[model samples]
Target chain A: MSEKIKILYVDDEPDNLVGFKASLRLDYQVLTAINTQQALSCLNNHQDIKVVFCDQRMPNVTGVEFFEEIRISHPLPVRILITAYTDVESIINAINKGNIFRYVKKPWLESEIIAAIDEANKFYIANSMLFIKNEELQRAYNELNKFAYSVSHDIRAPLSGILGAINFAREIDDVEEMKEMMYLMEKSLKKLDTYIISMHDYYSLQRGELKIADVDFNKLMDELKAIYTVLSKTNNVEFNVTINQNEVFRSDEVPIRLIFNNLLSNAFKYLDKTRDNRSVDVTVEVQKGIATLHVKDTGVGILGSHIGEIFNLFYRANSQEAGSGFGLYNVKSALLKLNGQIEVNSVMHQGTTFKVTIPSI
Target chain B: MKLAFIVIDDSELDCFVSRKIIEHVDKSLNVKTYQNAELAIEIIKDNPIDNSEGLTIILLDLHMPIMNGFQFVEEFEKLPIQKQKKYMIVVLSSTRNANDISRILSYNGVESMLEKPLTLEKLTSLVHRVQQGLN
Candidate 1:
């Protein structure tokens, strides 16, 4: 109902063309042509024409011939031939060849033409929907394949590390060596834990519904500070937070937390251990129903070449730390559902900053 | 026998385990670890021939960031055949990808493939095989 279904009619006789247009104009956007050439031009100009009707008798070409020719190029538009009883043999041939959808008898009634148009339009809509769904299914299949492959490696790699550490731990008796083995084992377990959590986040973000609520940035940051403060104290890294919100912002609380947690954890995880004073600065400002956040960290920054690929699923920029490669990808997915944007600026071995902006619902 | 070992893997923990297992087998053996495949390739390129009497065993992981194990083999194969023989390239990867396994094994430069978390038993037999000139 958005617009009339477009149909193209071709006939050698000008009067026939006129009659066809006059009868179908109220029901469809009727496009008429005097010959096959004009009909081809009509099809070229109006790509959206869903149905095409051609007269069987013409000067240069017959309706069946035109339909057969256009079958290769304009296959999407349903084709019907208008002919007399004498051309029944050729009509049968055309229909058998899969060139024409159906044929209409000459001196046709409006009801017959209307029936053909309705049926043809239905076929067009169904075919288009199938094509789109096919493409979506293919994309999903490819992502699922990559997801399964990466999941195996992400899960197996940590388990292998833990196994190896255990074997070494049993052979050594030095207390320092035993403690070091425990640390390594703990690190491996933590990596596995992060991978599992992000996998859960990925699943939820894909299938969960958005629950929009009034978001207070101060309270959210306070909650995050309490958790990350303990983490920062262990790593000897400074965590600073600043929040300024004069306007009420609304968004899905779960996704907002997911984004912040992933980004902040990455900030702490990738901190440059060689630096004397490593720090992560988080700034949140809300104004005019838009929340802008900046997460800057004095960590081992991303390579310029790798910045473009960092958001890709299972993409890891550096192997200096134990990472599941799902953190940034999850952040990007969450931000997409929130109608938000993120940009990263990084210099190798110096620092990295992520700037994110989300419009309130 | 004076044999040197090189462990190339992006994972720090894996590298540590490989080093430990190799040392457990032979404490006096010189074992070097590289977190980056490119850096490991640079060291191999720097040393044209095994000046030492002993052959070097390179334990390479297949799934590194910049340069993978297969890519390293491709680059190493480009070197002179004499230099290639001075060091035996052993693929120490945790990859279960069948295509990757067959493709890397097809390379003449690759001596053999081993599952990661290089166990003491595996290293012992590998060193024994190398000592007997059976690789």
Candidate 2:
């Protein structure tokens, strides 16, 4: 069995203190404090005390003042105030000052007092766990920062070489020759930029300050559609968008945009080369407080085996395809922040479809 | 005779820049550029390379509008082996993953994978290797 939690009960009257110890000692390690001085002494001695139940009224000093004085030095124990009905105003003030977790009226039932102690114990344990987790996260953040710095340096070295080559080609007045070198340089630079952006986005999502708000689905869809319109025209691809419902869905707009933009951009970029009639379809539907957005493209689709890893960071299905491969990774991270899910289906040469579902705010 | 090369990519800037790089390395080399892979593949299929003359190299871009580089490879494989042998395929992409690199290598006819906005050193090396292999 686990060691029992320690609790301290402080009162001016010896009888009340004895009554509390006799009842609570069966379930917990109870310590009795007959006055303010004795309570402070017990707190100083008992490092494992999880909670303190202090009487609001005492001869020399109030419970609030005593708890406040010791708050900085001994912070682990949760403090609860005990008071009669007449002392309600002072107890409320104590709560405001952060000295009291809760106040129990005088002549309290044994079950009520026990319940308060149990609740305080749970709070103490939860806070301790949170502190441990926060420390672990800080360590991870430091390691990631170091890695990002090294990766940036590695990427920049290659880019500088490529840039130098491009500049040299241009300086020679070799018009035809400079064109090819410029292309290669651009490719290297894009790869570097993609890597840096992906690392930054991944860390930001992990930090979990997701700003959620009500977003107009229709407006967002229209804006995205307009951006892709030019690309669709140049490629001779027909893009269609259908909104099943006009109702607004509440979610983090930024992540939602990130998910849809990546999926839609991929659809346009990888359209089927053999087919003369190329088309991409986007549909939005809201049902039962769930918003589902579907994006389908008539393109050379992903192989069944490769579909599972599409969301993985730095994973590109085909090396020949020009992409950072971070797009889908960002989409996945953003979806997680919004409490959303994505599903993909594709046939080898037919097309690919992605369905994204998000909880409506 | 010097080899004639063609670049297929969606970015006009990429095509222009890659053409310049290849030309810088080998001035006598004949190069053509296409903004889309489908158009480039169609031209390649229509104008079969003459094996008696010299080899033709196709600098293929993987991400394109109609037919991407991978789809072109799948279709290009269906061509007669004799016609395929007259041409060598090189993939130009921005992707940098081991799996993606291996997938390109898996193609039966691809000569090499070059990370894109094609650089002088990489292009020079590729041309040198091809010339050495032919000799």
Candidate 3:
């Protein structure tokens, strides 16, 4: 066979070792070791040996002792002990403790050894697959636990504030005091509403399978401008969008919208109050199967030390101001799922720019 | 001796509400408000009142951006004992987490915690406790 698995056979008598090798040579890459010392040497030489058959009665060490010793250095090899007695106490102990995967009687049958080898190989594979699956399950469980705790904490904080304000408002009568309390109530209500919307975005991103479509950039730009025009007008800011399409751009429309919405809203939200002519520029181009988009804003930029941590979940870059802080984090997560990438460059009072790239299949 | 009162919170409205409640407990009490913990720490460290005599009470919010209430307490501890200006801190928080409350209460100068929308009853009880401590 072209893909023969390697195996080793160890015994005290030279003739038995040679006979074992001669019998299995055509089916496997058979190796022979005369004593415990030579068996260790063969193991060191053939690291990929899938199974080992060792005689129970050796000169200085029992097969159980030999298996235990090699287990520390070479643990992956499936071990089989060759016992002289029908029900030896030490052989039973070795099998019980998993020191040896199996055993064969002294006058070994050719069919018996072959059967043991087949079963031992399958056991090795199953055990390794179980280890990998366990790790994956543990990781997924930890992520869900963290997300549930954080979502409950964030959503409840604003609601608690609103409830307390309503309780206090009923007993107060002065006009100015009433107006002030109403303002606080409105702010807390708005914060609660914003948090709920962000949670909705999170679930949508997680649940839905990606739908591939030929994205229309011009139509998307018009829609975004129409939606944000009122906000830009109130804040005295302008948005400029340009596109250069060398190929037909195609991707999941939902993720594309999610990325742009987060970036565009942040651009206008943090517009600098000191600058008279505030603007944000968005440019897109596709060439050689790569779609590249850039969003540059003359807004209050992130700090240098804080830039690395901005994409972290619930990380507030500036703790002085109130932001849900999930916008950019969501953008990054969406990009990862789409097999896309993003990079950001920012200067403290000057401006910020983000470059994003996604490939076309 | 003037009874100096300070309220440190991230919300402007929360600061306003606190100032109103502190005055309602003792009308003549000198009350100050800060929208962030850093500003209050600056005022406390750089500029102490000239003729202050009574025990200073601070109402501190736990979840500010740059320097939270716990971080402020850590920084406040570095000040010399005499420069502490006879101040005691009370956490005013919206969090109902028992673990957070128990851990925060273990700090050196933290005297108590009152769940938010700081009510008149809690303020009245605090005033009575302050008076009793004086005796």
Per-candidate interface DockQ score:
0.62, 0.05, 0.45
Which window of 10 residues has the lowest lDDT sum in candidate 2 chain B?
B9-18
**Candidate 2, position A132, lDDT:** 86
Q: What are the per-residue Cα lDDT tens digits for candidate 2 across A1-361?
A: 2898899999999999888888878888999988878888898899889999888788888887778877777888999888887766777887898877887888899888888987898899998899789999898888676555445443643454465465556546756555666666677677667667766776677776777677788888889988999989999999999887656567788778778878887898788889998999999898777998999999889988888888875566753435655779889888887888999999988999999999986
- The candidate with the higher TM-score, 1 or 3, is 1
Name the runs in model 3 displaced over 4 angstroms.
A1-87, A104-121, B26-35, B48-51
Model 1, docking class: medium
lDDT of 1 by residue, A240-329 (tens): 999999889999989999999989988998999999899999999999999999999999999899999999998888766566788899
- Note the Cα lDDT for every prediction shown: 0.88, 0.79, 0.81
Clashes per candidate (backbone, < 3 Å): 0, 19, 0
Ranking of predictions according to lDDT: 1, 3, 2
Judging by lDDT against the true structure, name the best candidate: 1
Per-residue CA lDDT of model 3 for A1-361, tens digit only, reads: 3678788999999889888878888877888888889888899988778899999888889889999888788887899999878548777887898798989988898888889888987876686678689898898788787676666666666655666566566666788997987887788677768767877887788777888888877788788888777778899888788988857777887888889988998888788889988888899887887888999999889988889988877776664445676788889888987889999999877789999998874
TM-scores, one per candidate: 0.91, 0.50, 0.82
**What would the TM-score be for candidate 1 when compared with the true structure?**
0.91
User: What tier of docking accuracy does candidate 2 attain?
Assistant: incorrect
The prediction achieving the highest TM-score against the true structure is 1
